[model samples]
Target: MTFDRRQIVAGLAGLPLAAGSASAQSGWQARFPELVMAVVPAENASGLTGRMEPFCAYLGRELGVKVTLRIANDYAAVIEGHRAGNIHIGFHGPSSYVRARTVTNGGVEPFVTTINSDGSTGYYSVLYTRADNPAASIQDLRGKNLCLVDPNSTSGNNVPRFAMSRMGIANPDQHFARVVYAGSHENAITAVLQGTCDGAFNWWNSEQDSNFSRMVNKGMVKPEDFKIIFKSDLIAGSPYAWLTALPADAKAAILKAFIEAPQKDKAAFERLSDGKDRGFHPVTHKDYETIVELQKFVDQMRRARS
Candidate 1:
């Protein structure tokens, strides 16, 4: 489904005034006693929840409303939460955000995105294999089992397919002996290291910041155990979005809290970025138009395969 730019612009223009005179005195807390922030866990659910606790508390303190974290099982669940209005805020990968927008019909608006330490607004999708595996490239891994993160993942699935077609492997499902979704970035990496799959697509901002690097730093895996065979061009950083129905003042307050978290809530900010980000930066739908087009292309590819 294509988005109407005029409708989106008109809706955005009236968002802040949505709460109207009722919110003028008491604000969103009166109407929304509690807000849920939904996320698809990349690692251990319990651990991720723990890591995000302080951030949720920070938001709660800033907004004068109770904020709770909801660990969604998959990307589609997160998208569905936004579509159903069960979730008030979301942290979504680029491709999944586009899917959410598509499913929600522009009900959600991206407010901010993470800025990499190098000051880039994007990250790379890398194809990896075990270090001991003789397979050195995507070609070498032909007819081998492959692991992907999620169907709606930007780096894990979308960019991987796009990059593979560029490399002359147009259909990964046909090229590989088997293709499977590991459901999370950590799962994809683990499958590769454990020999459950020959290769996997995951994200990398730099050697200093990535799922692999974070795992390595945590002593979960050694750096020598894996090798990167291929890397895709920079994909837009994921976004933290909110339902546009929120009061205008509430939106401003939420954005202000996020932009100031780097200084005011250093530990929570570091936890969110794994200590490798500069900070959060404002972004709009326009920033992800290319990603939306890419998602459309992938959707067409899927339909053709079916």
Candidate 2:
């Protein structure tokens, strides 16, 4: 668990300092002058660096502080960076955020999330079947082949499982003729389209930049190619969180920068918000209570199974 100080310092050097700032000011001096934010790759990509460059630049310029983007290969690495205090801020899924908060003992707090075009702060977990599938509802899917995203995914796995459980479908293996883990939302969608699975579960929101739309447009599956049989209640979207150890001034500056970012740099905001359909909005730890509860239930179930 030992990190090289030189390497950490080198990473921080890439961060931009606030305008006219002589020295970095924060309650906890950054191991380096720049703040490092970590994000999980969506489809085995190395990181979000390539996707979020504009957003990172906007943050640096607006906050008068250096902001650096770090990509983790998966969700667990994102959590680990937050726990180790290497990541000053991060964009994390609800379940991963809850786990990170627990590990840090309140050291992290969500500050902002994607705000949909309709001004909604939440999204849905959609259970979809092929266009011509006879299944009209969760109950009707019994004995059919099913595809699910990763075990750790929120809308992809957790919410869908919760929905099925509530509907009295206790075991998918018994209900579905077969069940397959597709690893990613896109994979699940593709499985259903290719006739590999009768149904698939994934997240759907107004945020347009997501790969979901890409797959749809690529003819992997048309909008009309599937039917949504179940949709979960709107759950809080993922947030950009900061470590509690950050200085009050630095934290305030960063929060203000994020809130005003859309106004100051509309293009950048749109890019980070996942396309022109949404922008960032203030969020807090309490916003994800429902997700936390869901994670607790999932964990309990996992332990019981083990």
Candidate 3:
């Protein structure tokens, strides 16, 4: 995946950068000369590079600095960038956020999350198979090959695995005939449809938007061609987070920009989200404690294998 700074038209007014409170008044400009932002490679780079340029320009104009966008090759690169203090702001899935937060020794804190069309801050991890398959649930997937997204994916891996654990099928390697990482949500669904795997994992908003829906919308797949085998409870959406080491004033401006970007520029916001999301809502580290706990559970299961 090629990560490059995109050239986008500028001069859009960002939502108010500062509030009336005294705390909001700081030399934010002097503190932040150049801002570097990264997004985990959740989709193809070309699409993101085209869609995100306006958002970056909005950030640049509001923060009184130059914003350089970096699309990472994979989740690990984004997490590593955050840990090394190279990325000032990042977009990360819940599972990757937890891992980055832990690996960075709590140096990353979430400030905002995507607000879905249903006004929820979460989505669901789902399993799908060919319509001809007799699988009614994940339990039926035993002895069948499975396609999973990356290990750091939330709905793609963490929540779905947890659901399996609750169903008394905690050990996927032992249950499935074989498990393969399809590298992305779209790929996972495609793998199942193409017969590369009998089952696949993906995620989407509870209100009718997901990887499957995206594919269907693009004419890549049809609704009647697949069956949902399992769906996990609401998993938190990805977040706009910044390294905790960043100065509070700058972080405040970044959060403010994120919170208001959708309302400020609907087209840019919609393009950036790539979903039926309304906007961003405030979130904190405490908000992600559930994900932290989930990661802990996943870790123990992996440790048991070692």
Q: Tell me, by lDDT, which candidate is best.
A: 1
Q: Give the C-alpha miss distance for residue 217 in model 3, angstroms.
A: 2.3
Name the Cα RMSD for model 2: 5.0
By TM-score, rank the candidates, best first: 1, 3, 2
Clashes per prediction?
Answer: 1, 4, 0
Q: lDDT (0-100) at residue 115 of candidate 2?
A: 78
Q: Give lDDT tens digits, candidate 3, residues 1-306.
A: 444222111111121222123333347655556677788766667656876888899888878787888776667777877766667788889999999899999998889998888787888887889999998988887899998888888888888788888999878999999999887777788788889999998876753577677678668899999988777878877888888877777888888888788777777788775648888889988888899999999899889888
How do these models rank on lDDT, best leading?
1, 3, 2
Better of 2 and 3 by lDDT: 3
Model 2 misplacement above 4 A: 1-31, 43-50, 206-211, 217-220
Positional deviation of 96 in candidate 3, in angstroms?
0.8
Question: C-alpha displacement of 209 in model 1, angstroms?
Answer: 0.4
The worst-scoring run of ten residues by lDDT in candidate 2 lies at 1-10
The residue pairs found clashing in candidate 2 are 16-66, 18-64, 18-65, 27-247
- Total colliding residue pairs, candidate 3: 0
Candidate 1 differs from the real structure by a C-alpha RMSD in angstroms, to one decimal, of 6.4
Q: Cα deviation of 282 in candidate 3 (Å)?
A: 0.3
